[model samples]
Target: MIWADFSDFVSHSRQHFEEGLIRAGYEEVDGGWSGQVEHIAGRTEIIISLPPRFPFVPPKATPANVADVPWSWHRERNGALCLVADDDHDGLWWREAPAFLEHIAAWFESCHGDWKDDRPDLDLDRYFHAANDDRLYIYGDLEAYRGEFVRFGTAPNNAMVMKGRGTRPAKVSKHLRDQFGYVADLGTVDVPPRNWKDLLAHIDASGYLERKIRERLIGLLVLIYQRGDHEGTTFLKVTPTSNGGIDVRRLRSGADTPAARSARSGKDSVELGTRGIAVIGVGAVGSFVADMLIRAGVGRLTLIDDDVVMPGNLIRHLVGPEAVGRPKAEAVKDQLGRQYRLRDDQVEAMSQNALTSDVVFQVIQNHDLVINATADFAVTAFLHAAAQAAGKHVLSAALQNHGDTIRIDVLPPLAGARPLPASASPENHQEPTYYEAGCGSPISPTPPHTVIETAAVTVRHAIGLLLDEPVHPSGEIRQLKHTRNQ
Candidate 1:
């Protein structure tokens, strides 16, 4: 009845395997039973290692010889026969020996396919490394074995663990030395990290070399879905550091998840991840900011503006001349879906007159963050008060003067040191604006580059605020000058 007892579960789970292997005259080895299984690909010897606690702990099975299977989850250095890690509900790992043998046999058969064949099924590696941070960078081609984790364990001499990477597991250490012809004596010799190479080159590089590839307590799976799905097996290495800090390096095996794509493409950032953002204007500045936020990976965006696009808007707005009649918000939303590949549901184009809309507060409440670039006095005053009442962070950016200087005001949540502007006119923030006599013309005719460049600066700060990283001078007006031909 003991979970770790292999004999109790043997007859119940794998009677045929035991009987057949015994009849074939298999031998006992490595604290378990061993036998050769013949498949279409070739003959592979299996080693089943049962621990003291059986069913509860599950058994560790490995192949006696090396195998190169295209099972999506590459393989470990010691070649762990990665069945289910803990088979509770028939998850990814080996639950019962008979079923596992059948599945693994299929895996072996899959290896026969050409390397160029594109698999339709999701890769097993996709189920691992859910964090998908580009934390590891290497010059070597570790494409097949990225995101592999190995618990090198604490050195016998007891070097401190670094960022949860170094664990000095004994069996894994010896395996690295025997297989890779490198020194990994954590008890006697200290381990060296990639950065330690410079120091070791001058003194000694053989101290902690090759230990990563031979880890026994291999971190085969960076992720194992608990409430979701199951996937496993990976090829990764872990070495020790002279300063006691461990560096975990993985390959570039990719996935379609946003996290994985961000890591692979080097666009991973706090504010760039999935988020609900509301932009209350899609003019030249708002349009440019919206574009940057989308490209930065803001998950869902709601563009709010009642004004229609004009021919002049084409020069500075995100859209072209053909979109002259469409509302700025709706046009930007369409562009996001059609050109930027964002789903229609991910973007919302609203034509609500923000200056007069009573639901502006409700709209602001629905999003995680609000951004105002309309630069209208009524709209700014309304949003400032409504956002504060709804307990949301809002950023307002506007052209303060004709001399290429723009100002952005950040309202950090719960930091009510200053009140919202009473009026958006020169009387409110004591800022200057240029407006010609009756016709609404630009103060100094802002250029496309100036507007876009200013929007980029505001967006950088807005991103930080969306992540709760309030921009410095939180409620104060921060004016930024554009870099243009003087």
Candidate 2:
């Protein structure tokens, strides 16, 4: 139901919206409004339509002759201009119709002027329809195959490709061939093809469109092309059209190589990607801390947890109900892998108990740092010993006082540094009022907010340790008190 204030705002703004459009030289059409904007080349026609959820959702403006639009970077395949980035929320463009129209006019002028003032963005994929169901995995160094063919394999939902030395297909194992088809690269193009016609023309001009190759291109074709400073891959699905022509659709693709993923991870990724971290728990705080580190571009992570996800843990845990029975470490690893397109080497899951695992000491030695989030004194002591032996740093976070307090302790790698004493339980710490059905232990009443906030703080210290930044005054105890109005 619409709120009274919202209804009133809409009711009052409807007349002003229409008047603003008229003032901007727009005439009421069948469904919306139509207007013309003068550009350097000539006049360009534009159509504006108010969405059903007006004011909240911005009005959409599409070019009359979308195909004739010079630039394809900032417009959708259907000709709707992308005036704002997905993260842009500063301006409430929908509230003022005239300002919105002016924004569109500015966009057209920028496009007509070759978008000189706009930042360079390799957005050629916006020109074609996206194939949501299918995904292409790009592996190896694509730049090495600048003007050569590579080997690729295709399956129903997934496709894999790797760079080749030259035009010859590299020696691929039969097992890989069975999993991913090992075929010669379809072709290579210097520039991204805007449409199937342009793709075909490029192939023909390069003399790569032989009769045999043309037949092979009827189903699936992989093209390596230059996208700005780097080379990128595009997977095209070809189907015979009713008019005896071929339709090429671009499939969704992701980089499966470390370099590609690192490039997308931002500037600090290079440094973070080389550092390895080991998280000794996959509980609520541990799970989010690991996830945040991965998102911050940490290249390698080892998740150690023997606990399985339970329904009762959903309130504060990262995994969902689907992972209720799965090992927390494995579940978190799977989720992070899929979300970040991480390879197996990038994330390792150890489902063994960290306290008794034979490899715990080795894990501590292998990683640059170790994190203890188990909130159990025994586990903390075990990790502290292992970290001390390996001369590695350890950061530990826990909620105390029935979830009303947050405590974080940082142990440096220095020889004489010692772990801080655990805080004493508050006098008012009462027994849990609720318990899971099967478990005898009472559930800790920590809210989700406290869990996440603790995790954020933990990750900040963890990153500082990884980067060799000083995070002195190492021990912190914060009480989260509720404020009430007098």
**Clash count in backbone of candidate 1:** 22
Window of ten residues with lowest summed lDDT in model 1: 183-192
Whole-model alpha-carbon lDDT for candidate 2: 0.71
RMSD value for candidate 1 = 21.9
Q: Which residue segments of model 2 deviate by more than 4 Å?
A: 1-15, 38-45, 51-53, 62-71, 78-80, 130-194, 206-217, 259-267, 276-296, 299-370, 374-394, 411-429, 433-453, 468-472, 480-486
Q: Estimate, for each residue in 1-486, the C-alpha lDDT of model 2 and write its tens digit.
A: 569988888766666777888988899887678998776677788888877777666778887767667545677666688886656556556567767867877887887676665554555566667654355655565555544444555545566555443232246445644222112232433334567677667554554443324444324455655434545566655555667566666666566676665566557777988999999888999999989889889989999999999888888988889999999999999989988888889999999888874677788778888888889899887777766667766888888877877888876534455545657776555567897778988888878998999998887778777777735446567777755365
Q: Which residue pairs in candidate 2 collide?
A: 153-181
User: Once model 1 is optimally superposed onto the true structure by TM-score, how far is the C-alpha of residue 242 displaced, in angstroms?
Assistant: 54
Listed in order, each prediction's TM-score against the native is 0.43, 0.66
